[model samples]
Target: MILERQNFMNINQISAELEKEFTNKSIEQEDIEKLQALARLYQLYQAGANEIGTKLENLDAEFQVNYDHNPIHHMEERMKSVQSLLNKLVKKGYALSVENVRAHIFDIAGIRVVTNYIDDVYLIEKMLLNQSDVTLMQRKDYIAQPKTSGYRSLHIVVSVPVFQSTGSKPVNVEIQIRTVGMDMWASLEHKLRYKTDIEAELVDHYGADLHDYATELSGIEIKMQALYQKLNQYKN
Candidate 1:
């Protein structure tokens, strides 16, 4: 699949729009649940920024996540330096027009889970599926059967607990599990889509090389991370 760049503005711009829209809106019929969901989304963004930022606070001043690119601006390049979970209450109705709400949410909410190996991706997928508070709505294993365009990742829909005053209620969440290699390719692809729309470069010269490197490195990563697993077992 081609990288798609929507009319996605930065967080600051989105916030300004929201402030303006809500400021003069005393008569708009809005549901409380939808508003609460939007609030939760903003809160999650803050939490993610905090968690990743603090963990890498002491990193080298010159160190960057992407190849020759600034990590702070493009946050996801830091090899799992980013972990995001978005919550939104999509406006739903019992009709075809509203049915697209669910589709659109998946279009943007889930993050690309970049791991080092195929096993890592499977482990994460299984771990979340086993969660008592999470319900698996669906799963599409693309790693096993990669796309015609050479994309490798797993897409899953899971519902998580959202504890309301009454009790804990299940809320659906979108999860896309991949590898660092996948993220690199996806990142470049997204950039190209922005530059040329669909008619972007048919094959990324630099991206193909990066993909090969990631595939080889992933093997080493699996071995190294597995050693840690063995250590934990031995310690136990």
Candidate 2:
């Protein structure tokens, strides 16, 4: 316990020094308090992501036991780093304060749910949204209307209350639901567009090819969905 307390004190000292450096001013009690609060807020966001992940896992388990089918193939959850959050706030012309971050940023925590079939995406979405605690703040149906770059997914921003020592605080989390095919194309497309250094004309050529590939993937996903429905028609 003594060692732990020493470590904690050292961490606090480091945090205060870092804050002072960033602000270019002497650290005061009020600033220390604000920094602690900001740290708690990030912890809350990570807890929110974990809460959503648990909900998705539970739903998948329920489907498997009750319906003999599992909709969710896999899930990925992430929390935005402090640097990333600050960068985004600056890019969006928002003030660099905890208050502005809470008010403006809704995607500090994110989850991506990948399903086997396209319809499974909607099924999981409906089930999740039906929960009372999950409040839908925004919905963007890119699957129905694909992006110009051929990215397709159902994006939803939701607020879920996370219980804390003080009280229950509502936290925002962004959810993306898509089929395996869509996820595959999106992953590769992102790499090609962002990681490569092809010339302008070649980039255009690759872009067209990627668009065509996305279309083909969509068609394949639809067919796979139909096949799944036919196979499980009598099971459920």
Candidate 3:
């Protein structure tokens, strides 16, 4: 029987511990970041794994297999998260630990599909393997690539391993996908986003720009989605 990582965490324990963690003296910003990181990762792990599981168990036409770079024992890993993050911290130790913050410490990433057709999702997700200081943690094909207005699809969750005192375990990540049209909108929105939210005057000034790009991207997504559907039919 396959041991599920998501299976072990008891909601009751998590809730009780969270309450306990909060109640004990002070809570720092970095501590909150750690909590949020864990929550996001756990959520993605379950959702993404379930998605892969469905494709594996329910559907036989397409193939889905574990993309294990190195075997992570489900039970052992769970123990690490629980013992190291949840249980080990005390009033002073947790506070001291938070002081050591580093970039590349945490990452959320996704895989995208970037082709004209549905078969592209499969072929690219399957064949485009790469080498270097890289690990293909997970693959999700929407395009299978970045989109135009920048509306994209497909989400991948990966554990990017980092060498820390935390040992050799890879940190989890999430990735998103978009088509060319969607990506264009998204990229512009990202460029524009920095300006609007900062200054109300800028929001008034650039609000139109954001709306224009969003509408354009939404439209692009619609047209491209139809193309994807048509492509799917052709494949069938």
lDDT of 3 by residue, 101-169 (tens): 112222222223233333333433333223132346655444334333333455554444444344544
Error of 2 at 175 (Å): 0.3
- Which candidate would rank higher by TM-score, 2 or 3? 2
Off by over 4 Å in 2: 1-32, 234-236
RMSD values, in order shown:
10.6, 6.1, 14.9
TM, every model: 0.50, 0.87, 0.34
The lDDT per prediction is: 0.47, 0.82, 0.42
In model 1, which regions exceed 4 Å deviation? Answer: 1-104, 197-236
Candidate topping lDDT:
2
Which one is best on TM-score? 2
Could you tally the backbone clashes for each prediction? 0, 0, 38
- Candidate 1 yields a Cα-based lDDT of 0.47
Cand. 1 TM to true fold:
0.50
Residue-level lDDT of model 1, residues 1-236, one tens digit each, is: 11222233445554454444346666344433344444445434333323323332222123333222122222231111111212232233222122333344433234345554556577556655664655777788877776644556788866555544566544444557676666666666556545564533554664566557555655665677688567657542
Backbone clashes in model 3: 38
Model 1 residue 102 distance off true place after TM-score fit, in angstroms: 5.8
